[model samples]
Target: MTSTSTSPSAKFLTAQRSELLSRRESYLADMARSTATALELTEDGANQDMADEDGFGEGDTLNVERDRLLVVASEAKERVAEIDAALARVDAGTYGACEACGKPIPEARLEVVPEATLCVNCKTGASLRRK
Candidate 1:
């Protein structure tokens, strides 16, 4: 097939890339806020280690919340990193190409996941890597 991105595909990718970048920025800001809150609470001795409403200390509850928040924040950070990498690909003129097999990822897939690094087949293989 086609070696280059079609005009329509290129337009879609551009829009998708822009949307992903916006999402990445929002996530990064959220993560930074979460990290700062984590630090603040930690410094204030609010990191709790207990569960339950009244049986547990405030510190324990805070810790649990912060821990959960950290998990989410980390995932968001990873997404942002992925988006950044996709942006780099755009700059390098390979924005819509699959990283795994060097094929053009379908526009439909890219529209759904702007930060995708693999085409459908490659992505499926990767998802099964743990098996």
Candidate 2:
């Protein structure tokens, strides 16, 4: 059934959409900050002269920080992509359904993880298979 103003499903989907959009914006901001920090660290490392021992240590530290920031940025980007996919599912009227089992995902679980594509049982099974 399609979402209508009077339907509880419609309200749930609307709430999910709002939460997903908020999370997407937060992740995007995090990615931007992390990327900027990484870039700055890279630039700082490049500007340091590596001929001296202290320069070498400082540069190494900067490189390590940059790597960490890059990882953070990458994770944020991945989360943003997931959130985008969730938004797409919302638009397609499949937001509350499990992709793997075609069952309705619990509201509690959805409240905790708005981007979840699989229900708990399927998710557990998938995780077990991966291991």
Candidate 3:
């Protein structure tokens, strides 16, 4: 895997990668807090027997919200992983090359989708296939 990072795309990818990593860390921390709260809710209900029905409903809602947040956190983690892989490609001298066609992914495309692994043509093809 040889890189062809000759233009501004490499710099943009680097910046995007760093930003994604930071965002990922933040998301993970937030998710951890939510998880801790969820666990505490279970503990409180089990041993203490929270008698407030409204409060129990609220807790249930929070659990649902926590589940949704966990999904979002997982997605952020995946995005971070992709960005890390892209950075690794940069180190391997293969950054910005389309995985599908082995062509250079345009800087504009990279700007729009920093974690893109395929060029527009390949991506379009993939979308069409899904349809």
Highest lDDT, which number?
Answer: 2
lDDT of 2 at 8: 29
lDDT of 2 at 59: 89
Q: What is the per-residue lDDT of model 2 for residues 12-103, given as tens digits with 9 covering 90 to 100?
A: 88898999999999999999999999998887787785445568888888888999999999999999999999999888777878888888
Give candidate 1's TM-score: 0.78
Model 2 residue 123 lDDT score: 98
Query: What's the C-alpha lDDT at position 128 in model 2?
Result: 100
Summarize candidate 1's per-residue lDDT along 1-131 as a digit string, tens digits.
47444333566757987888788889899889888887776755532332334635676776787787788789888988898998888777778888879888888888888888899999899989968
In Å, residue 70's CA in model 2 sits off its true spot by 0.7
Residue range with the least summed lDDT across 10 consecutive positions in model 3: 1-10
What's the TM for model 3? Answer: 0.66
Q: Which regions of candidate 1 deviate over 4 angstroms? A: 1-9, 46-56
> Each candidate's root-mean-square deviation in Å?
4.3, 3.2, 4.4
Candidate 2 local distance difference test against the native: 0.87
Candidate 3 on 11-84: residue-level lDDT in tens?
57577667556766775776677567657656665544366655766667666766676676567567667877
